[model samples]
Target: MNSSVITPIGKILNARDLGKLVRDLREKQGATQADLANFAQTGQRFIVDLEGGKATVRFDKVLQVLNILGVELTATRRK
Candidate 1:
């Protein structure tokens, strides 16, 4: 993991934040977009769109990548 990359926790402010975090994590693991896509069982284009912060990508696919990267997200009541 890059030393400058701070692991995101709690609230993700938006798609771009999520994308950056994902990209950082992927790079930390030394995995290419294609490699991550294969591990997530998703298309490379999906990974591309995801890391590029394309907001309209399917939610399930996002979960897949997060799962494969060992990032856990939990839903909580917004105060």
Candidate 2:
């Protein structure tokens, strides 16, 4: 897995963009929603909702899902 390709998420200005990112990464890893939910210890509905850009998703669960997908979130000051 190339770190650079996964690291720069470009301009993720909203939830729909975030959802698309998750969906793309999941598909690249050959994983199903159920697989991701089980790995993240979340309900399948959560996965569905997350990928559908549900506005009220839990951040903690989002972190868990990202972890299960082998991705990490980073914070840095804007240049």
| Per-model RMSD to reference | 5.7, 3.0
Which residue pairs of candidate 2 clash?
A: none
**Candidate 1 vs. true structure, TM-score:** 0.82
Q: Which lDDT values do the candidates have, in the order given?
A: 0.89, 0.88
| TM-score for candidate 2 | 0.84
Task: Kindly report which residue pairs in candidate 1 clash with one another.
Answer: none
Highest TM-score scorer: 2
lDDT of 1 by residue, 2-78 (tens): 87555556467788888988999999999999999999999999999989888999999999999999887876677
Total backbone collisions for each predicted model: 0, 0
User: For model 2, how does the per-residue alpha-carbon lDDT over 1-79 read when each residue is reduced to its tens digit?
Assistant: 7646655766666788878889999999999999999999999999999999988899999999989887788766878
